[model samples]
Target: MTPANARLARLRGGIPAVEVGARGIESVARNAGCTRLRAIVISGLTPTEIIKHVFNAEPDIMSPFAMTLSQAYERRLLENGGASLLTAYREKGHLATSEVKISSVADHAPGGGVLARQRRELETQRLLDMKHAGNPLAPNLILNPRLPLALVGVTHAIELDYMVASDDARSYRVGVIKSYADRGGKTDKADIRAACREAAVGTLALRQHLESRGDDPDLAGDRIDMVLRAPGSFVPRLFASMRAESEMASLVRTLSTAPADLDEVEQLVPAGTSFADPRVINQIPNNYRSNCKEHCALWERCRAQALAAGQPIILGDAAAEQLAAAGSITRALDLLDGRGRPPDNRAEAALATELRAAALLLDRIANG
Candidate 1:
């Protein structure tokens, strides 16, 4: 076969990822099916989605140097340092404005190839059976310089959320972030307030998702109230920010009752910004995508620790973790510790359904 044909074969097959990135969402989708792909994307790295998006336009994304869709996203990500989407703008003194780069967008179509030539497959990949799907926007992402961070934003589409959450036939979207300071081996006041902010931010997000669908049929009697839990995400960042027990205690009042004004919540975000930016969700930094319960390289360690000691072992060497306070960090670790064990059988079975559907999608592609 010619080199181009050979390259196509390799791209569609399963392969290990290269670069700072640890894995690929496309391969996952290709192997498991679109539903599984979406769930993995939602539960895996944030850049994996972007990488998948980018490659959808340019299938031959690999370089002789070994730049997989995974690696490129990481390189672009770390270049921005620790800046979340909103901070990238504020740090540059452009709080109210920013641009979403286009070259950063995915070039490949939905089924591992260019879209214009093969449109039928894309429809199938998107229309798989779904319960409650969510569409996450990277803010004009497909439009120059891609946004630096994965800011949290809310979208109202049923397909994407199910895809992200393994299409469990459930409709709810949730996100969390926590920050703290590390003063030697202790947590301080700064750390406490930060942890408080993390909890508040997550709670507010849950509130938004719940309130947005208040009168909708999905919720009225059924629970448009789908579970919006992310204690693990919020608690860690808070522990990173608060270094002392007292500091953490001081923020208790605010945590108990989130203020009407967002300034209180702004205190939680490292960039000191609010959700005023229409693209707040899209602007959230995607750096932590892979670090969640599902895909972190440290999962095994945490699993052993949680099973043995009943807690999370979140002592990452990343600069982001070190910068946070001990209190916030510890709380997050505790929350993660709680999640180490697998979900209850019911949830697991739902997740299994998603994986099978994804595999089916891949089967369709392989046959074509």
Candidate 2:
């Protein structure tokens, strides 16, 4: 097996490149699963923390969904019609839109019977002319070591609810993963807590349901415990972290036969886009989604209304800056350092406490 440091280096430096035109919001949303839809914020830690301990990263791709989607879609398109249409489309637009249109002279206007038949024949034969590859997105996105945050939890078990595009002859799925590995971190107690307070004001908010420190964790790191007395009418916040780490993956794979751009590859994810007719959600008897009670970030509004006829707070996507803020490595350091703020977790706080206690030991080791 590759050594852990090598793996960390590879993840940092080995990302693929994509043409500029291929970049879009879809992939970003899919990678991070953040859209203008119902949004929530979350925090925790996992594999990423360990990697940071092993290898330093700057300007990391915290979440990359578009690339994951492109990987899923391209394989399907190329196989069905060969690469001519795809190639042509790419040549024309370079991969920005979610839709495409194809046309032939024979289909557009009347041609001689022979000419029309030849045109149809041309399409059939042309597809056969080019050899095609099999699916690439199915296994890799799921198996990648750097799974997405949406697929993880405090328990570290990965939940696979990723996307899929299946039809006759082949299938590709982007399995949703959940693990504590990508959990958000909070060291900026004032900043993050302030934001949380803003988010919680309308609802009966949180008072540190749990705490952690870096000294030791009941689970992974040190832990923090809290007692939350809420109206029981609150929304459990969950940020749209990446469902797939297309941006973070080193080097491209079979998604394309050649070198690829991680930036462009990420544009094809579908998560940030809207779902079908969200407005009609209340009309549906059981609601279009059975798990909406738990899944919806606006669950508080839903619960409040159902319980005590509370007024509605419309659903919206998680705040982008806030989500981005939670994942900063600096914040991790703060949690570990405890310089100016409260440690978000007991594990982090304890580590800081120890680091201060062992400052001379740490300095001696650094010099050595």
Candidate 3:
């Protein structure tokens, strides 16, 4: 077989491995802060009605706006940020010997060949040498650098925006270029949180690389420098080394635990769970919420179900959790209007009493 065909074959062989490895971090994050939810997502059953088929839960939905908007936003951010970074680095007095050099990983895609291996090794060594030499511009604003890592029964080639030297000079931090404008030195909270999550993925990959090379992995923090636009302007602003140690640790643990969950969930999947029929897919149990509409493909159907059932999840997570004691809107309303009795449990009864009082207050105000 020709070299190209040989490369394609090798890539095909590693497809499952890549899925198990590369998607581990993302799957882990998707189910974060809730283990049951993790089980659903990691099983590849999330935002699907499969769970509903089994448990009579809501249909799965993905909000088109959330997914499309974010993808477009990130693409724009990275393109602009790359140019901005080169300029920013040069402005810091580091002269680019030539028009900013970027190591394009795609030229050698579907790796494992000797040339590909050498290219990666050379880039890795260059970064290391710069770090050892305390070169502030060691990573050189790499356009798309791939870091190879193996963890928790999976292996992934993690791509990063750029690997930059940290403030300490001896250590390095992942450089995550975001498009969010830093207004008054503050960006959107949700955007910052999402950026940090992506940064953690890069950091984990880097730390794994460092450990494999016999370097001190601890020196690498789950931190990233967010390069974004200045508040109300198009100029780049450098936000140095924002650390999210807790987020990083949580990510690692979640990914580490995901493989086992995936195994179990796959086992639970029925033999005839094909998507040939829309009704079959709708039978699958799904959890729906206001957030689901932003990212899930099945958001509309799931949302209709939530509205029909009057599930508090139609509001959002906080409201759903807050009203969980009532179980449904109708039950809560019944309690407030003195038409339905609260459960015999003390905590639930207390909640009912509070709702009743609030309802009475609202009634009095409305009448007045």
Which candidate number maximizes TM-score?
3
After superposition on all C-alphas, the RMSD of every candidate to the true structure, in Å, is 25.9, 25.3, 7.3
Q: What is the lDDT of residue 106 in candidate 3?
A: 37
lDDT of 2 by residue, 1-368 (tens): 33532322333233221111111111222223222111111112111221243223322332466445434443333343323323332454432344232222233223545455445434422321121123232221111111111111111111112212221112122222111121235333332322222222101100111111121111111111111111221211223221222221210122221112322222322333211223322221211112223223333334333333211111222322222333433554455455567766665565556546676688889998
lDDT of each: 0.28, 0.26, 0.58
Number of clashes recorded per candidate? 66, 61, 24
Q: List model 3 lDDT by residue over 104-215, tens digit each.
A: 4434343866577557646765666566556656544555566765543334456666666523456667767665667753656765766777777778877776686688
Model 2's TM-score against the true structure: 0.19
Scored against the true structure, residue 92 in model 3 reaches a CA lDDT of 57
Stretches of model 2 off by over 4 angstroms after superposition: 1-29, 36-338, 341-345, 350-362
- Number of the candidate with higher TM-score, 2 or 3: 3
Worst 10 residues of 3 by lDDT: 11-20
Question: Which model scores highest in lDDT?
Answer: 3
Arrange candidates by lDDT, descending. 3, 1, 2
**In model 3, where do residues sit more than 4 Å from their true spots?**
1-83, 90-140, 148-152, 166-168, 231-234, 256-260, 272-289, 293-298, 337-342
